[model samples]
Each structure stands twice: as structure tokens, then as C-alpha cells.
Target: MLFILAAIVLTAHAASYGVDIAESISTSSIKCLRDLGFNSFFIFRAWRSLGSFDPNAKSINENALAAGFSAKHIDAYFYPCFSCGDPAGQVKSFWNQVTSKKLKFERLWFDIEGTWSSSKSSNRKFFESLTNEAAAIGIKSGIYASYYNWEDIVGLDYKFSRAGSWPIWYPHYDGKKTFSDFKSFGGWTSPYMKQYNGDMTACSHDVDYNYRP
Candidate 1:
């Protein structure tokens, strides 16, 4: 009986998985992840400041709260489309919206994959500025990108080592499902989050599976 009880307790405290969604997913899809035992979510908010914000962010947040799941916000404004106007302008616009709306997330993720910003120096400056803005508002920030993108955008050199200090969320779908499969890369000894699979399903809706360590 004691052994059986221990098994039950261990199962109750097992680590939970989560998913990342965007405008492509409806508010109703939030339930899909919850039903799959996901305890957290990261919903895409915007591609750029000038681009449209996700119309379903609030609904997803509300639904996640109702389902007893934590929901966070994500944005792809780091290297926005070149045609989206000035990068600095978009950063300011994004920061303004983030402050004015009172998005109650403890942390935010900045997507760092795009061809608009070519120079390494420009990209590094943009990242520093984004981190500063988030710090001013008392919100922690993380970088979300694949290992390839990390090496390509920031490199593994001493100068780019600054990125490893921040929280790293690496996405790699290499058919290795275990968290142990995610090894350190690009100067980061350990990643905060690892997107191990991109073909996960919940309630018939497709979502990416992420492991939070």
C-alpha cells in the first residue's frame, strides 16, 4: 500500500508540457492544450509594431485562466519585415502598446529570426534596446529561436556571448523527444525552454510542444 501511494504522489507532481499559439489558433483552441495536460502557454501577440496584434490574445488569456493554466505573451518585433518601416520606430510602438495595455504577463519572448536586419551589429543593438525596455517595466525577457538562428544571428563568439546571459528558448525538432536531448549551444550552457517537437496535437488542433526546465 505504501508503494502504491508513493506512485500516486509522484504522478501528481509530474512535470507538465505546454504549447505555443498565435493568431492562427482560435480562442477555443486554448482548451485544446489544457485538455492535453498543458499547464502553460505562450501566445504570439504581434509580428511587428506596425503589424496587427493577435486579435485572440485576450480571449486565450481569459480561457487559459479559466482552465487554470498560465499564459504568456510573445512578439516577433526584433527583426521585423524591412518594409514595415523603421525598426526603431516599430520598437517604440511595440513598447508603447505593451505598457498601455497592461498585459499581465510576468515575462515576454522576443522572436529573433528574419532577413530584414542583416548586420550583426544592428541586431545586437536592437536586442539590447528591447531588453532595456522590458527591464524598465519590471518584466523579464527571453530569446526564442532555433540553434541555427542563434548561431547565425548572434554567433558563438565572445562578442555575442552577451545573449547567453539572458533566458534562452531554443526550438529544435530533431526527433529527439526527451528533454535530455536538448544540449547547450551558442554559448549557452543551459536553455530555459526547449521546443522538442512541432507536430503535437491537442483536441485535433496542431500545436508545438515545449519543455520548460
Candidate 2:
């Protein structure tokens, strides 16, 4: 029992414990994880791009609250398409959804992949405006991308290039780069450099790591 307790403690700090995932997540699983001391979770396919939107966010929060999670215990966000629309439309849509949602959340995550930002000036303008939009309504926002992606697709040193808004630290196990420890991953691709991502549906008993970018 003592060993088990120690192991749990050790694993808890390694990453955000969005470890194991299931086909469909249940309240019991979420509750059990919270009881185990996990305060964060990643929601899989938590979007409504096409058909009707799922009430998963609110429902999950409901269950989590029943299990003992306050608003402080949960953080939720989604995968956003950087090139979804023109700059203005993108910012409008992002905040529109956030403002519409009544669900209690801590942060908004924007995943920038496969899209090209026009220029540093344009990127900074849009990003800063987006951050200001979220903050104006009392919400926190973040961006997910690796250093390589930033340098290649998106230019670094934008006005909003700081780590808090756009943390660049990534996960690498090949021993080539030794900055970030492996953490929660959102997709199936291995070697993710994120502290927490929504890879699966259910929580797990495994360990996860967290770090700054």
C-alpha cells in the first residue's frame, strides 16, 4: 500500500494525468481519477464542426463536480484550425463559441497545424487580438505547437510569442533534444511535445509529465 501510494504521487507530477483513454468516458472513471488526485483532463473529439454538438463538456463537468471537482479542478479546450477562415472570421468564430458556452472552463487551446501564417506582423496582430478578446470576457487562452512548427510554418518572435500564450517546449524521447518530458498527447502520432492532450476518452492509471515551453 505504501509503495502504491508513492507510485501514484510520482506519476501524478510526471504529466497532466490524461493518461489512459477509453472509447467513451464515464463519470465513474472521471470521478475515480479525481479521487486519485488528478485535477486536469483532456476531452477527446470535443468539437461540433459538422453535425450537432455534443453536450459532453457540460455533462462531463457535471459528473466531475458531483465527484468533487470545483471550477478550479477542470480545464477544457479544443483543436482549432488556424486557417479555418480569414483572420477576422477566425477570431470571431473562436470567441463566439467560447462566449456562447455556459460550461465552466479554465482555458481555451488553439492547435495550429498544417496552416501557414502570412507574415509575422499579421500573425501577431491576430494573436494579440484573440488573446485580448478572450481576456476581455474573463477567459484564458493558449496555443499548441512545437518549435519546429513555429520556425517552419509559423514565424517566431511574433508580438504574442511569449511562452504563456505560445509555449514552444516540445516532447522528445529520441535523446536528440532534452528539453521537454513526454506528457499528454491529443492524437495518435507518437513523440508529442505537449504537457496534456486529449488522446483518448477515459482516464488511466499511468503516469504523465508536465513542463514549460
Candidate 3:
């Protein structure tokens, strides 16, 4: 039946589609996105650039839950301040904020695209400390970056030891929901998630579309 086939297609589409949100969205808008077949949501937990927490982190997470998203369907991301000394300390501050606000997430994604220090060693140390500290706190972590960004920030030759184990969420704004273009970098031969689109609106909310395949 055509109806049955459509349902199957929608289910498959939902399984691969997700969105990462930075702005605060209402519960109604969250529900709208869910109804539109977005299966997962990644929310910003903190903004390390300003050394401050995202004021809407708690509300947006609570709203997502209220809209029927579970812990497994939601995750948090942090944008680190590259020049912020003591990367471990920054992670501590991030965790503290998460606990203080009681925000629940399945994993923490490190947003790795931005200005960097002149020293590649310093940059590598910053990323290493971030993941190491996340492990210390018993929370899983992943990287959100493109091959170009990764190579620029950490250098292509320097492969991270834990890259094989840690999942990677990369970005390629080609508007296609597949990972056909992912180039191996940072020791990751493949990606766990691909952000195929960025800076777009759906359900009247600003979101970057992502896919997991």
C-alpha cells in the first residue's frame, strides 16, 4: 500500500536525521521539530568563549524532555575557549555548570572549529586535556569538526591516540544527508555523525541539520 510505504520511508528518514541547536526554543517548537521527524537533538551546554554557561541550557533541555525526548536522544556540546588556559580546568567548570543545572545528556561534543593558538602542540594539549577530563568525570565525549578544521587546528600528521575509540561528528554543508565526503583525519577513519547542513531554520527554530549513518 502507498500509505505503508510512506510510513516506512519516514521511519528510515527519522533514523538518520538529527539537529544541533544553540538557541533557546520553546516546548511547542521542540515538539514541532520532533513531529517533523528529527530523531535527536544536541544542545549547547556552555559557551567557553565568554567563560560562561549558556543561560538557556537548562530550559532548552527541560523543554526537549517535555517534548518527549529521552536522555538517549539528547546530548550536550561545549565550545571551548582555545586561549583559555588550563583546558582541564575549563572542563571542570563545564561539568560543574552541567551538574548545578541538572542538565542530562547522553554525551558531550567538543566543538573544535575556531581560532587557534600558533603552537600546534598547545592546541593538541588542549584537546587531549578536554577528552581526558571528560573521561575522568565518567561522561562520554566526541568531536564536532570538519577534516579541514581538524587539520588546521591539530595538524593532519598528529593523529590522536584515542581517535579510534572516540566517536566523531563532522560537518560538510553540501546539503546531502550522507557521509560520502568524509576524509580521514585525527585518526578517525569514519564519522559517527555528519552535519550535512548548517545555519538553517526548521519549525521556526534555528538549527544545523545532522545525520547518523
Candidate 4:
């Protein structure tokens, strides 16, 4: 079974996103955001290890799913900032936990927050290979990063992160956040939600590319 299932060991992706504040929110707090059009935000924080990161989010994924959002919208950011083991092993563990028979997700999010010098290169290659594996399984793969990281660490000339046609979930918070992907990941909290849930939108983007026609 392990050999036949070597794909996950190859690269399927696994990263965490935000902290664990969503768990403390009012039972209805999460719904309020979803109710107020904040339906797609993740709160899965990751831990970067030696040469890879492990992402096995259970609490967050379950909470979001119970709240009524589709599994696709309920995503996590996997940060492999310090991975050293077979990226394949870590990736496999994540997939098994994430896509268990009970909960089926259509896509997984790959976050590259950057950790060490070598990590930058390792993360780049990992994501590239993950994009291919995800496609084979009929799932979407993506990389999350800030504008500064994009232009600086990832380099302006590199094209593979965005090349697999995987959508980019860029997190930017000034006043409002936007994206060409139509879907977003930030700025949904306000004075009211703050009191009720104390959780804020880590990032948000416009996946539709709406132009107000």
C-alpha cells in the first residue's frame, strides 16, 4: 500500500494558515462572517521543521466544514519552510488526514512563508512538483505569499509558482484586499465581529477579476 501510494511522498502539499482563534469564537461567530460574505477564510497555522513542515489540521477543518462552507472553500496554508525529510512523507500524512472518507476536499493550499536560505529553494521546487501531483488527483494546488516575498525571495524572473496555472492567494492588508483569482483570504473582521469572535481576515482576494461592468 505504501509503495502504490508513493505519490503523497512525492508531493501533494501540506501547510497550515492562521492561528487557533476561530475555535474560541462564539458558536455562531464563524457563521456571522460566512453570513456577512466572509465564507472562505482559513485558520490553520503551520509548524516549520528541519527541511519540511507538517500540516495535519483537524480542529480548524472540521469547524469550517460544520459551519456550512464547501470543503473547497475551507482551506489551509502548508508551510514547508524547514523541511528535511522526504517531502513525500509529510505530504502523504497531510492528504490522509485531510481527505479522509468522511471529509473530501477538492483542493489544498501550499503556503511559502520562507524560513532559511536553502528553504527558499526547497520550497520553490516542492511547490512546483506539488502542482503536478494535485492536478493528477483532480485537485487544485496553490502557493501563498506576501508581495514583498514574491518580488524579493521568490525572485521576479521565476514563473513556476504561477505557471502550473495554480491560483495565487496573496495576502495584503492596507485597507482592502483584492485578487485576480476572484476568491480571497482577508479583512472580514470589523468592530462588531471583533467583539464577538476576535478573529480578523488574514487576507482576502477577488478571484473573479470583477471590473464593475
Which candidate's TM-score is highest?
A: 3
Per-model TM-score, in order, reads: 0.75, 0.56, 0.91, 0.57
Ranking by TM-score: 3, 1, 4, 2
What stretches of model 2 exceed 4 Å from their correct place? 1-16, 19-24, 32-55, 86-101, 116-129, 157-213
TM-score of 4: 0.57
In angstroms, the error of model 2 at 50 is: 7.0
List model 2 lDDT by residue over 3-56, tens digit each: 999998887566544322212456787676666545555333233332223455
For candidate 2, which ten residues in a row score worst on lDDT? 183-192
Candidate 1 Cα outliers beyond 4 Å, as residue runs: 1-12, 24-28, 46-52, 70-88, 158-165, 175-177, 199-201
Error of 3 at 61 (Å): 0.7
RMSD of each: 3.7, 7.2, 2.2, 14.9
Please list the C-alpha lDDT of all candidates, in the order they appear.
0.59, 0.47, 0.82, 0.44
Quick one: best lDDT, which candidate?
A: 3
lDDT of predicted model 3: 0.82
Please give the distance, in angstroms, between residue 146's alpha carbon in candidate 3 and its true position after superposition. Answer: 0.6
> What does the lDDT read for residue 127 in candidate 3?
84
Q: How does candidate 2 score on lDDT?
A: 0.47
Q: What lDDT, from 0 to 1, does candidate 1 have?
A: 0.59
Distance (Å) between predicted and true CA of 192, model 3?
0.4
Q: How displaced is residue 132 in candidate 3, in Å? A: 1.4
